[model samples]
Target: MQQVFVFLILACVSSPGTPKSVDVDTDDDVLTGLEKKTLELETQIAGLKTEICALEMKMKEERDSNQNQLKGVSANVSDTMKVVGDHTAALATLRLDIDSLIQSVNSPPPTPAPTDVSVCPGDDWVEHNGHCILFSSESVTWNTAKVRCMYYGAHLMVVDTEELNTFLKIRLRAPDGNSHYVGGIDFGQANWIWDSTNTEIGYTDWRISQPSNGRTEHCLVVCSGSTCQWNDVDCYGNKKYICQKAAVHG
Candidate 1:
């Protein structure tokens, strides 16, 4: 363009007079070229901005998807726990019903007992009504009576029902014939516990105002002698005791 313009200028300089309009046309062309370059740059900038906006939206959607998955996992875990709890409760009710049916036919009805629903490691000490008796004669201290129960095949008796109490009264055969030493108490623990294995079972028959320790008592003893009073005496004392022998069930 410069060569062409210079050639035209020379041709004009050689002519009689040059035209002034040519200069104005050359300035207008330069302005038009600059405007085109600026417009192209603006288009490219707009395209980049659109791509950035799309990337941000994709990242947000992924985050939301992950959070929803975590929520589903949590809900599944809660449902599983609820199912286990329900089954456990149902099983307990079933055992109670069966025990009651068995007792009805057996005159001198067996007592209602809290489910020994568990398969305790030793001999399964069955509870009639609420009372359970041991069948051994292991010599132990006031405290030892409860301990040996776990080792030899029995737990200190824990009577949960009234029929169990009467049966125990007849079975213990105590010299005094009152409430005698039984296996129940935490002695030094926070809660009321059975002497044998310190079972923390909640339900029990404390003979109103008995087990007065407020958590201070450490042993359980029943009196079957003529006195018929239950007390928590020292565990070291030795006394003549009887264990319940199993009844023959047809």
Candidate 2:
């Protein structure tokens, strides 16, 4: 509008007598050029606004995608922690169970109360050390004595302790001396093993210089001497035997 006013003033000054129609025509041409430039600038501004809006929308979408991925990662982390916690609890419980099992294994078994000798199964049987023992008066070979004891649902006596050995020595004492077969036998290994359980004998009452025969003397016998010590002997020798069985509860 200013340029239009300026051109009008110039035309009036430079040509006072010029035709008013020509001046008005020149003013119209200038107004048309300014309008075209204004339109072009407005169009460029509109295109720039559209581009800014597109860029903002794209940035917003990217931000939302990143947020969603973060949420998924957080959820996976929570789930992994939960699983780890569960395993930790299970491991703690298993450790407790193992400790309990170890304690049970290490604890000793309860000892039963002592029983009276009168409660033995028969008149010929004697109660000693939680067992009922029968001392056979008849003599037999070691193998035959073992079979005879089995016939009575018993095994040859196994004296595993010093007290039991002393008790048997007193019980087997008689005016006429006689040897008795016990449970021990060497099964070609040179180590004396109890026939009752096939376990190596851990206790013995061997007399001085006895068991000197090595493999030749494969059987055990309780001698009738005053000391009533043990001696390795020939398995085929005839001897009285002792049989033993667990005592009846009732």
Candidate 3:
């Protein structure tokens, strides 16, 4: 409208009946000024768009960088968790080993008793020195008597000396007057041996010609006396056997 008004004014001024002067020059200058202003506004808007693009790109870069860092951190945490799990397992194994070692180091050691204990709950088996002795008066086969003694967790008696003989004299069966079977006779090797054990023969009270290695004598028997000794006899001959076990036969 202003340009139109200027044109009308110029038209009027330049009319054949009218006169022209500096008005035209001033209007042209105003038009030039408006055009310059428009150009400047456009330049400023373009600069703003460029700056916005740069900022958006920078923001995107930062976001991507942060996400990458987060990923790294997450990976590190996963690795750390795995390491912790491994360490926990190792600690558990170490604890188990430590417990085993503690048990091995702190547990009680076995005593040097000849026999650890007797199965007879009532203390029926006599405990003398370190040996647990059980005397049987009922006449039985050598094997049967031995089995009975073992049922009580013992074996046939082992008479080593006159002292042991005297100790067993009180336990002997006098009513039957039957010589009991005692652990002796190495007839397996044609010599005297404690059939109850593979013990090194320490003490022996061999009656004269007692172990004659006779065919009828496959076993040995004992009686109480300073001259108490092993007598060879048939293994099948039933008698009251003296069954004994060591108190601490270590």
Candidate 4:
């Protein structure tokens, strides 16, 4: 009976001590799961780092491109401003040159030589080139002036050449400020002819808008200023005249 009791006690105590190998296997499984999770996390972190590096490189490239564009725009604006400044300066210089040219144009010309009185017929006559010219003081109509010149054995002055016209303009600088009658007359048909020579005057110095073709403007007269341009006026209107004759040769 004592031996039977001892066997029962041994059977109760010999239950495998709570399975130490199963515990060891469970611990190994947990360590393997933890290692797998750690490996996955490390892979994810490495991918993120690569993505971040790529993003950083793209941002740097874009920034460099924007800076280059800004520099190009700035350079273009600077060049445009320089061109504008140069144009403004050139315009200013051109204006000054125009003003100087206008002043020079308005100034009077130099005086010519004295009249050769030896070739003229009388004290009132002046010799130039080959002609004797007389400036009349009395104002008269075109027909009356021609008649008076004919009585003096002369004709109304004819400006046949540039030299003769220039001579007359220089000599006609009398301070009386009177515009003188010439021999030019357009006989109601727009065809101008010198009455004395019955021909076209070869040289002409008309005013800017002379020969306005007014109803009665048929006679020509030298203007009153230093610029001795010609103008057509009414033949009936009275004006001082110039007479011309061939110079006497000794």
Q: List where candidate 1 sits over 4 angstroms from the true fold.
A: 1-132, 135-139, 173-175, 195-209, 214-216, 224-229, 240-250
Q: TM-score of every model? A: 0.36, 0.50, 0.44, 0.50
Model 1: per-residue Cα lDDT over 72-161, one tens digit each: 988998998899899989989999998987887676856777553423223644445333445444455655555565555555566545
Instruction: List model 3 lDDT by residue over 147-218, tens digit each.
Output: 898887788877776678767655553653347787775655675777778574567655686667777676
Superposed Cα deviation of residue 59, candidate 1 (Å) = 99
- The residue-level lDDT of candidate 2 at 159 comes to 83
Instruction: Between candidates 1 and 4, name the one with more favorable lDDT.
Output: 4
TM-score of 1: 0.36
Q: Would you list the clashing residue pairs of candidate 4? A: none
- Model 2 regions more than 4 Å off: 1-118, 174-177
Model 2: which residue pairs collide? none
Top lDDT prediction, candidate number: 2
**Candidate 3 TM-score, C-alpha based:** 0.44
Q: Is candidate 1 or candidate 3 better by TM-score?
A: 3
Quality of model 2 by C-alpha lDDT: 0.86
Model 4 lDDT tens row, 27-126: 9999999999999999999999999999999999999999999999999999999999999999999999999999889988768766654377789988
- Against the hidden true structure, what lDDT does model 3 obtain? 0.74
